[model samples]
Target: MVLCTCFFVPPLQAQESPEVDIGGALRFNYNLSSWKPEQKTRGGDFGYDLFRINANAAYKGIYLNAEYRWYSDGFGGGMLKQGWFGYHFSKNKELQVGLTQVPFGIQQYNSNNWFFNLTYYVGLEDDHDMGIKYIYTGEKTEYQLAFFKNAEELRFGNDSEISHSRYSYDVAGRNKEINQFNGKFIYKFGGNVLQRIGFSAQYGSLYNLDTEESGNHYGLALHYEASYKDWNLKAEAMNIAHNPENAASTPDDTILMAAYGAAYEVAADFNIYTLTLSRNVPVNWGPVSALQFYNDFGYMQKQEDDFEDSYMNVTGVLLTAGNIYTYIDYAAGYNHSWLGGNYIDDFSRGTPNANWEARFNINIGYYF
Candidate 1:
């Protein structure tokens, strides 16, 4: 046996890999007319809509993500959209704890329209809260569960100026609503034409600080999406049941009825349905590398027996090239606030009380 003389080799130090990425977005908006019926002639507004910064850091299996934004008009100050830290067991699973988005409805929404759908106005979509959440993304399924405290509307003070636009609706006042739980699941199937179906639910308990009473709110949603060729279609329907004590005395209840002609009293419920269709145009010329046409429709039915139904329709075209994007939309509404019409339960303003209006909106964004 040949003896092999070997020198001792020092073990290499295990290096810790770290990564960080920073990004930001700048947006601008120009309006041809205002949405409020009382301010029909107001238009020619041009200014910065939003400026935001996003950052992410990762080391080992731990990560941190944050987003801070500045809005020009309504908010009038910087705000934190999301800030979260989590441990990632794998690429498909994570447990996060911090201020993050409430995973109750379609993630990021399906419409390219700037205002989104009616669900957003009711605090069911694109809303964030302080929460602890777990997410699991499998090959054909995705699941999310979270428990939140101090939702977006309740977390902020009531000093901000209120506008009739979509960005100014705050349903949760200074109420002590806590222990809100949100859950969602989505399953994907189909081959060439990809398809997905999802279900989401949220529940919370509210304690009226003013009246010393307690109540609850529950919501459920079903959504579906499909992609065929260059066209994408999405449909969502949701029901929200509100059972707040002394609902007639709540500011949100009063605003809800006054703004949208919907009452959220004891056992008050409402249903919303939204449908969107988008297609990519086969044009990749000049500075515009991509073009898409989209249309969105939303309908809301209130629980009151004599209440008239509300609807909104938006049509727009979007263009994208590199990190620059822009969209132009024409929106119309019946019995909707942001869309133009102002519906009141009493109809005291008469039959022709500016029940409908149309506006042109353009938004441009740059990402870096």
Candidate 2:
């Protein structure tokens, strides 16, 4: 027994220590919007936008990743963007637990602009929740399955009211999202030009606090992506339905969604389609290494009668220089939230005669 114990102790002592890395970013923004007439008269506005910290650590097969961010007061003051612990069973299989990104149409992002797309406004893109995820990567295919308990909760207990200070939009106000299941599958075609086709599905229960009853929501999407040389293209289409068991006084055709310290009503049933194209060009300009020019467009068609549709288009260029990155974008929208129209009515009832509004924005960031 003593000889066997001695042999096991040496192997344990030889194990490597954990590797840790910490980094952060500081960013500032300048923008001029046609919607804000007063700001347009003042030659637009420039201000601090975000400060963030990222930490990652790995020990053998276990790892952790987290990010915390501080935004301007108009946005959420401070929030946890993501935090998760993961275990790698092998090089191609892993599991993540905690506040992780929801497995949806696209993996990281569906758009390549500062302002994402109409899909993001409708809570379909880049949405994260409190969940556990399992990922499998094969030679020509990938799979992801997840179960989210809820969105990130700001406080403890059974409080019915959810806070609006968050990074991801979720069902708020009288309804909360619960018991969500997500599944995504992707097939890759390898050649000179890499191509991928994927499908995603989601189903969740909407627990109404006011009525003490549960409703349901579901979404389905199909997406395709391709890259050839310096050119890339992405396209996706999806349909979503939200049925909330609200109080008798509330409308059934709309639901409340909250993020960035604000709440707004969104159409309950809608179909969204998006397309993006980009080209990377190598440059020899001073301190600027490369430039990527992209255009992203999204359209939303509401299902209710007399409801106006929403659409957005963003044309942007990203400049990368060592640790400094800059994005210059010209974005235009019609009856879209974050672009123009009334706060709570834009995505719900909308204005039939709404004119196109445009904004010019520049964002600079230093990452380390």
Candidate 3:
């Protein structure tokens, strides 16, 4: 999520801006889930509900990041997490020196809803670590490398709804990286396609700061992507399950998969995208996860002539569960510079817990 407002004026191209400005996303959340809370006496509580507020800052190139949210302290015995910070380096090289997330884990895929679809189509893995990153930029080339100290991986299906980073995969996976390193490269061709390759490796214990044998670990990742006009495709393969600890008492434990996605402009004001994923639960293909995949389909529609602002979108999961639930969103509002900052847009209802849940969020989205 991000924020950028400039009223009483028209859209300013990059060449129009002189100084490096700052911006961010200020989000407020209100939801009601069907899960009941536990009471001390009855060893049970009632349904869980919460009101939350989150703010994220974005500085042109200096920094762009968000928070973990702690607006509501009481949410079914859950833990709170603060956001992270990243420092921009010379050119594009950067050193994220805060509680940033792990950059590995997911491949840079092509999807119209990648930016807004939180659960239905996108996967954001958060790891608590004081890390650093180096990004290389060229005319048609790009690369990135990241590392972490106290690394942790969130559970797949268990990290949603309220997205609480509570139990770590280190339970069955005490696997932490005392030090983790990753690298990726992207090159453009004459046609309208991009080629990408990513590699990640790490070593350490359950506690990144510890030296326990039971928590030692290491792994690697590989990915590829191509894009043309309003269409794109991506695939990722990995072997995180591989170990000298296979079920056959052999060094043969691994999980691998390949994913594909495509998008097309259905109309001038609407774009449609669909993704298909397959995860290899049977065997490991070399250093790749055989079939760890899911299918995500979405539609993005918007209209902006010279009047108001509006958006309607829907993302659905056609693959496995624990991967993504579903989402529906509609937003519309207008901005004017002559007056103080003020805006409101809410074209949705029946959200949160309804069978056909609809998420309609009204945002004042004020900024100076």
Local distance difference test, per candidate?
0.68, 0.89, 0.33
lDDT tens string, model 3, 1-368? 00111122232222333333343333233222122123223443223222233445544434445433322334323332334555444444455655555555334323222223221211222334456655556767766666665433333332221123331112222122345555556664555544454454444433211222333344444545555443345544333321222133321121111011111111112122333332224334343322222233322222223223222232322111232212222321112110112211111111122122232322222221
C-alpha RMSD (angstroms) for model 1: 9.1
Task: Sum up the clashes in candidate 3.
Answer: 32
Query: What TM value does model 2 have?
Result: 0.95
Please report the candidate that would top TM-score against the real structure: 2
Residue-level lDDT for 252 in candidate 1: 38
For this target, which candidate reaches the highest lDDT against the unseen true structure?
2
- Location of the lowest summed lDDT over 10 successive residues in candidate 3: 257-266
Runs in model 3 with CA error above 4 Å?
Answer: 1-64, 70-82, 105-128, 152-177, 194-197, 207-214, 242-294, 297-326, 329-368
Taking all chains together, each candidate's TM-score versus the true structure is 0.82, 0.95, 0.43
Question: RMSDs, each prediction?
Answer: 9.1, 5.3, 19.6
Rank order (by lDDT, best first): 2, 1, 3
Query: Which regions of candidate 2 deviate over 4 angstroms?
Result: 1-15
Clashes of each: 0, 0, 32
Candidate numbers sorted by TM-score from highest down? 2, 1, 3
